[model samples]
Target: MIESILPSYVVSEDLFEDPPDTMLFPEEEKAVEVAVDKRRREFTTARLCARRAMARLGLPPVPVVPGPRGEPGWPSGIVGSMTHCTGYRAAVLGRSARVATIGIDAEPNEVLTQGVLEVISLPAERERLRELARRSEGVCWERLLFSAKESVYKAWFPLTGLWLDFEEADLSIGPDDGTFSARLLVPGPVVDGSEVTAFSGRWLVRDGLILTAIVLPAPATTAGSPPGASPGSELIGS
Candidate 1:
């Protein structure tokens, strides 16, 4: 479902259940060695999803460890992101040469816990979400907007290697096109001598899940080739 919005170079895969220990790579097992059973399971399952995505790209599965800030440290020639939630786990991978960056997020299709919408959303964003809720039936626009910001931050951090607060970005959602745009209130990331102050992405509400994804092409006029290495925000399993 997430693939529909991405470019052809990106490969995404999703899993609906927790696989057994047999799905883990040796190095991956070591990375989650200290975690309790639950964390370990979630981490391993996400990695497995990543490996399957890599396979679709014709690349072998490599241990996707945690970087300095707990972001996924993808394999040498891959740019990717991972996310997981109850009953769902997913990963999106793209060849570093063809895709600049990728960000995908999954959230349960439910309202945010009390106070979280205010904590993570701007006053304007909250007001817009309220209006969206009145128009869309059976959708939690608050959580959907939260997921959009999460996707924006996930993409922003890797490009800038800087932190993006939840309230720092403003979002506008389109009901008809399944697309949203984010304007960076702070100075944006510089890529290939150009500054990116805004981001655009696609979203969907499906099967009790809210999914949002962003994909940036190679900085130059070509298909394959990205800039220097960077890290992104750490996700809480999902």
Candidate 2:
């Protein structure tokens, strides 16, 4: 499902499993020893998926530890993201030379928990979701919106190293096109030496899963050059 939106050079991998108790690297194994069995499985599986993606890029399959904020600590020169929900796990990766940073998320197609929507959405976002739900009968617009926000934050945090409030991004979702645009409500973060005020991403609802992805390109070597002229790549799903 994710292969369509990503650029050809990016790698997107997925697994649905009760992951085995694979021995993790020292740091990662120690960190997860305290987690419940289920949490441990999810975390281990996500890391395994990440390692495989990186290995495909001709990089070593090293241990992916957690950063200070619990984001995956990828190998040097790799920019990537990971996400997992019940029965679903995925990881996306691109060489830092091809993509500056990337974020991907997957969620079961379902409604947000009661009152959760009210907390995460802006007034305008809620209104937009209603219009979208009216137009697209099958999608859970609330959940799609939430997933988009999660993708946005995933892409945002690596660059900013700061928290983005749920209401901080104003999203305009086009259900018909499976695309979305998020305009930063706060001063946007500086990425690769440029201030990014907005982000464009793609989303799809398929086989009971809602997936979304966002990629930030490395700044162009020259102002007018094309995306791939820089050192990085972006992800898209089929």
Say which candidate scores most in TM-score: 2
- Give the whole-model CA lDDT for all candidates, comma-separated: 0.77, 0.78
Residue 62 accuracy (lDDT) in model 2: 88
List the candidates' TM-scores in order. 0.89, 0.90
Residue-wise C-alpha lDDT for candidate 1, range 99-141, written one tens digit per residue: 6667888999998899898889888987888788788787788
Q: Candidate 1: deviation at residue 160, Å?
A: 1.8
Candidate 1, RMSD to the unseen true structure: 5.2
Badly placed stretches (over 4 Å) of model 2 are 221-238
Q: Deviation in angstroms for 23 in model 1?
A: 3.6
**Candidate 2: tens digits of C-alpha lDDT, residues 1-238:** 5756665657877888855766678888988989998889888888888877877888877888887788888777898999888888888998777666787888899998999999999999988888887777888989989888898888888778898999898988877777887888888777566677877788888889898888766665224334422232222220
The positional error of residue 64 in candidate 2, measured at the CA in angstroms, is 1.1
lDDT of 2 at 131: 86
